[model samples]
Target: MLELDLTARLGNFALEAKFSCETTGIVALFGRSGAGKTSVVNMLAGLTRPHRGRIAVNGTVLFDSARGIDLPPERRRLGYVFQEGRLFPHMSVRRNLSYGYTRIPAAERSIGFEHVTDLLGLADLLGRRPGDLSGGEKQRVALGRALLANPRLLLMDEPLAALDQPRKEEVLPFIERLRDTLALPIVYVSHSMAEIVRLADTLVLLSEGRVEAVGTIEDLTSRLDLRPLTGRYEAGAVIRAEVVGQDEAFGLTELRFAGGGLWVPRVEAPIGTELRIRVRARDVALARERPRGVSILNMVPCRVEDIGAEAGPQVDLRLNAGGAALWARITRRSLAKLQIVPGARVYALIKAVAIDRTSLGRGAGRFLAGPAEGNLEE
Candidate 1:
């Protein structure tokens, strides 16, 4: 487990962050600018000092003001990847990567240079200088250099913030690969919801230098009260589903969740492969009764759990589909016309095309061709 409770004063901004999460998968610090996301990571990296608090990772204490204990950045046993690569322009990629590896005593080294190079796809770029590498490639080299440090935890402060869309996509899979293949824990910092939804296993939501909430991505994103912070335009619900069947004729794949089933565009994964899907509220249409002969391919029975206060002409609804949480956004006119209220049964209509291919993520587990297992609510 990673635990942190810190309070700091940075110029005019005051930061009070406190949270803990398992040291498995990714824990994302998500918020807007000046939310203290970077400040929290800086404290974790020993780059900044907190007024009072303690920080411990997997039972190892990194800081304790009361105890008067603090470890320097080098002794913290943590790897940091900044937004920029910050590679040595004068040296070849191989030598740059070896810099950290060679600094560690052989007895303390747990990660090998060759393994990191291969894992990050840096083997081919070893001979090239940092000036000759693409943005994504340069970041990959930075990742390699960090891993070679054999740290217990990894801290990434918007590692993709400097990259373009294409470069971001290029590096994302490699990060996912790193998470799955290695036992290392990661603390990822980002403001991008797409990045948070795609990569985070646990989420820490910060607003104005404070932790607003801490939970899984689905729990935090589907919340009605958090709409203002989560962004109304990009707000949606996330659900975990498994491939149950395939429609060869229509080039579609069937996914089954605890709540219901959805037929989406063809998923390349084999049957029983678990998937994480994000259903945007704007893409969902609700009806008082199930519609027939509609162009919409996905419809699930849901009950209105709660209706958010009217925000101008639009209102958000929290729905319960089976045991899973779902969200919908509709105009007040539609809400009044349909008379949607808590406990009212409704059919949620979703267009297959509305599901973005990029939002589909591969879950860590694949089942044995039976009933869908795993908690969608989790």
Candidate 2:
């Protein structure tokens, strides 16, 4: 487990960051630019020392102002992957990876070169130089080099931010493989909600150098108050569902959550596969009752759990359909005209196309459990 409660003054900006993450997969530091995400990671890396508070990983104190204990960068045993892959231009991929692997004593190195090569799919690029590799390939080589170092904790600062969309997509699978297979604790930093939802297990939302909120990806994305931080355009609910059925002729797969069965673009998983889907509030429309002749393929009965504060022209109504949480964003005029109130039954309308295929994720091991019935109001 990683425990960090730090206070650092950087020029005119003061950073008071604190959050604890389980020693598991990815714990993402998510926020806008200049939110002090990098400063927090730097403190953990021993690059930037906090003026106050403490930092520890699995009970080992990395820093403590009260106790006057602070470890230097080289002694921290933490691997850092910066925004760009800082590989030696002169070295081959094999030589670059070997640079880190050779530094640690033979007994201290648990992750071997063969495992890193196979896990990162770096077997083919072993002889290639950094100049010949793509942006994604270079990052993979960087990751391999870091893992071979066998650091206690891995710190990644916007690793995917430097890559284009296609390159980002290419590198994502390899990161997912690392999250699933490696036992190392990873602290990932990103501004993209899509990346956070896909890879992060715990989310530390930072705003203006302070920790705004800390929760799981599902909890934070579903929060109405954090909408401004989650980005209005990207705000939505993340629902965990299981693949129940498929329509091969139509190229669609049916995923059942507590809310209902949604028909999405066909997934290659088996029937019992548990997956996570993002339901953007923008795509949801509310009706007092289910439409009779509507062309929309997906509609579920939901009740307003709560109404969020009015932000500009729109208002968010948090809804619960068959025990699953969903959100709908509509104008203030529509909310008033519909007389929508808490506990009121309404039909949540959604279009399958609006469900972002790129944002779909694989849940961690276990499936979600709740009232599986699709029609809560029926």
Candidate 3:
């Protein structure tokens, strides 16, 4: 368990946060730029001292102002990956990785050098220096170095912010593997909705040095209050599904969710893969019935769970598809015309182009096979 109740004053700005969680998985501290995310992380890392409150990780007291039990960053056994790769430019990748291992006594080293290298796909670039690597490669090396230290907790502050779209894609899978395969707990800070949707198991939302909301992705997305902070276009629900099959002829892949099968653009994944799909509220349309002879390929029958009012002529609808949930944003006029209400059964009409490709991850096929079999049932 990780618990924190900290307060800090930086000139005119003040940061106060109090939150706790049970799992050791990735906990994303999410918010826009200058929202006190970095401030909180720095305090937890012992880089900055908080004026009051305590911080404990798995019963270990890292900071306690009242008790005066603050520990230095080095002794805290925490690994930090910054926005830019801070590797030694003069050293080779192998040398940089070895530097961490050399610090730990051989008997105390829990993670091996070769293991870190293989996990981050750094085996091929061991001879290369930081200067010779791309943005993604350098970040991978930095991650490898951090893991090799076998820290109790990891801190990532917008690790992908410095990279372009393609470069970000290159490093995401490795981070996923680390989260799923390794036992290390991660505190990842990011402002990108895509990163939070794809990577976070738990979310800690902050606004101007204060904790706004903290919970699972589903819980946070469903809250009407958090919607305004997420921005209009980025508001949506994340659904888990499996890949059942593919249609090579039409270049379409079949994904099975709780409510039914969703045929999106062709996915480059194997059969029986698990996937996390983000269906934006703006991209979903509510239909009164299962309309036929339409170009829209994805439609799922759902029950209206809740409705939320938005600024400037729109309302958001929360729909339950089988056991999973989806969000739909429609104009006030359209909602009134359709007479959509809570408990109303309707089909969510989704256009093919609305599905964003970059949000799809490596395990897109996993979700298609597991739940797809029963999702087609009426």
Candidate 4:
């Protein structure tokens, strides 16, 4: 396990962060700018020291204030990939990657040159310099260099923050490959919910230099109290589903989820492929009955779990559908008119087009990672 209980003061900002996650897949440190995500990353990298607390990976102590155990950056055996690749501008990509490998002794090197290069798809770009590589390619090289070092834990502080959407897409699969195929643990830092949904197995939500909440994507996204912190514009529930069928004539695919099936803008993945879908609370319209002649193609039966305190014109309703949580936002007038109440069963009508391309992602396991409030992030 990767454990941390950190405290530090950088200038006027005070940071106190404490969280532990499995030493596998990706654990994302998520929040807005200046939330101390980078500071936490730096502490893990041994670039900065916390005034108090302890840090360990897989039971190996890297830092302990009480014990006076502090390791230097190099001895920490942690790889740091900054926003920029920070590659040696003068060297070729091959040499840049080799620089990292050269730092470790041969007896301790578990990863080799060919493996890192091939894993990142940098085989053909060996001769090119960082100046010639694209934004995404450079990030891959940074990752390759880190992997070649055979670090015990990898720290990425918004590596994709410097890339455009297309570039992010280019590097995402490679990161996924590392997370799924490799045994090493990764600590990914980002504010983007899209990246978190696609990459994180466990999410550590930070706000104002403190650990606000920590849990899986399914768990954190469902909390009504955390709506504002989760970002009002992009707040919603993330549902896990599997590809059950497709309709070639309409260019749509059927995803079998916990409650029912969803027909989305045809995903290219084959049948039996699991998917993670974002259902915006605003996009969902609750119906008293299974309304006929409606254009909405997706309707799942749900029970009202909680009604968030409505200080505004609209109220947010948390629903439980086939054990998965969902949210629906509607005005007070509609709520009373529909006579909706907690424990009342209702049909959640959703338009497929309402789910944007950015909202769709991949689902791991049986879609249940001990569901909580991150997307509740769900």
Q: Per-model C-alpha lDDT, please?
A: 0.85, 0.85, 0.84, 0.85
Q: Candidate 1's error at 366, in angstroms?
A: 10
Model 2: lDDT to the true structure: 0.85
Query: Considering summed lDDT, which 10 consecutive residues are worst modelled in model 3?
Result: 365-374
- Give the number of the best model, judged by TM-score: 1
Lowest-scoring 10 consecutive residues by lDDT in candidate 1? 366-375
User: Candidate 1, after superposition: displacement of residue 169 in Å?
Assistant: 1.1
Steric clashes per prediction: 0, 0, 14, 22
* Alpha-carbon TM-score of each model against the true structure: 0.93, 0.92, 0.89, 0.90
- Give lDDT tens digits, candidate 1, residues 1-378: 999999988778888888888978889999988889989999998999999889999999999999998999988978989889899999999999998788889998878887787677787899999999999999999998888988889999999999999998788877877776688999999988888777778888998888899898888988878777887888899888888998999999899997889989877678888788888888888999989988999899999999988658988888899988888888999999988889999998889987766567535221211113221212
For model 3, the superposed segments whose C-alpha errors exceed 4 Å read: 266-273, 341-343, 361-378
Rate residue 233 of model 2 by lDDT: 81
Choose 3 or 4, whichever is better by TM-score: 4
Identify the superior model by TM-score, candidate 1 or candidate 3: 1
Regions more than 4 Å wrong, model 1: 362-378
lDDT of 1 at 145: 88
